[model samples]
Target: MTRVLLLGGTTEAGRMARALADAGVDAVYSYAGRTEAPVAQPLPVRVGGFGGVAGLVAYLRAEGISHVIDATHPFAAQMSRNAVEGCAAAGVALIALEREPWQAGEGDRWTHVPDLAGAVAALGEAPRWVFLAIGRQNLSAFAGAPQHHYLLRLVDPPTDPLPLPRAEAVIARGPFDVAGDRALLKDHRIEVIVAKNAGGAGAEAKLVAARELGLPVVLIDRPLVPERRVARTLGEVMAWLDG
Candidate 1:
């Protein structure tokens, strides 16, 4: 039996786990436990960090994991790096199941930034209504400029300790429709859209809505992971395993 360690917390991760099970590989789905209401998957699950790369190496060694599949969110750079290094240290094969990043079309308005701090600065000093889809962890950077009213979306309801003071939470999941996204932007009177290029149809409707509304978007670039063999979809991964 192949002991596969799947690092996931994203939608693609769950799908990948299902694919692995269907391929007859014994899989362990691992998460960092950031969200309250996590996405459901077919495999057995583990949560919490591994105390960095050293701890992860220990886990890989003890569990006799043959493969490490990185199906984490694109913004999850640090964990991805840690996994790459840890798996190398433990002599395990690593494959990144990464979705392709979104591209801008002719009518698309985009401002690319290196990181979230730069993203906030690029927004300028105006108190414009903003739709922030940068996830909960990076919200602290926006606290410095709280003059803007933010419409925040998350899977779980944020606790009282959120960074932005004038922010309203919308508890929901996606694949959001273009119509719903347009309505959201219209209802919130959003002037700007801040997002990471987490590709796929799940949150892609927002990009189309932003384009239609002529809203300028501050896009945070996806972090670079170590160069490795990448499978764009679960089908490609299973093919790799078969060969």
Candidate 2:
């Protein structure tokens, strides 16, 4: 049986969905339902979590899913960890499709941090204009560092009042270009960008824009995940599936 369960929330997942659908592979795409409007996948798609590792294992057994491809965002460590545990319990083959992490290059001003809390600590006591790009879930942590004025870029607007007193939200999606990001940073007077090292073209323009503006970035490293079979590209993941 070649039935596959693809846990997806990134550009890599979208690409894999297309590849799987084009090849007429028996697969199901799943989203954690964090986004208000998720991009439609070609295969049958499911929304919401599988509860946890136990729920995931139950779903795998019920669906008879033989292989699992974890194409989630690099920051989605919890779900990835659950996938590793659930798949192992189910005796199903599993592989991760992780994008390469971003590196600081020449002309780039970066302050590397291990996590979101570390990024917040790096903001210092000065009330600088900050562009916090890490998504809505982690925004609460920034409340501790109330000195900085933050510009948050998110897919959907937050229904509740934001945690920070000096924060503003810009509702938008990406595949953003350098020109637009440059304009955004300048218009907002963003002194620094706080972002995760989520490697992919879709959200990478901000880094380029930051480099061009000579703005320092508080780069949060991806969380360590359980070791698993990994692939960097959609083709490689597909090959692993075919094999």
The TM-score of candidate 1 is: 0.97
Runs in model 1 with CA error above 4 Å?
Answer: none
**After aligning candidate 1 to the native by TM-score, how far in Å is the CA of 130 from where it should be?**
0.4
Candidate 1 per-residue lDDT, tens place, 4-58, comes to 9999987888888888888778889998999886777889999999999999999
Highest lDDT against the true fold, candidate: 2
Q: Give each model's whole-structure lDDT.
A: 0.89, 0.94
Pairs of colliding residues, candidate 2: none
Determine which window of 10 residues in candidate 1 has minimal summed lDDT.
234-243
Error of 1 at 49 (Å): 0.8
List the pairs of residues colliding in candidate 1: none
Clashes of 1: 0
lDDT of 2 by residue, 10-34 (tens): 8889999999999999999999999
Q: What global local distance difference test value does model 1 have? A: 0.89
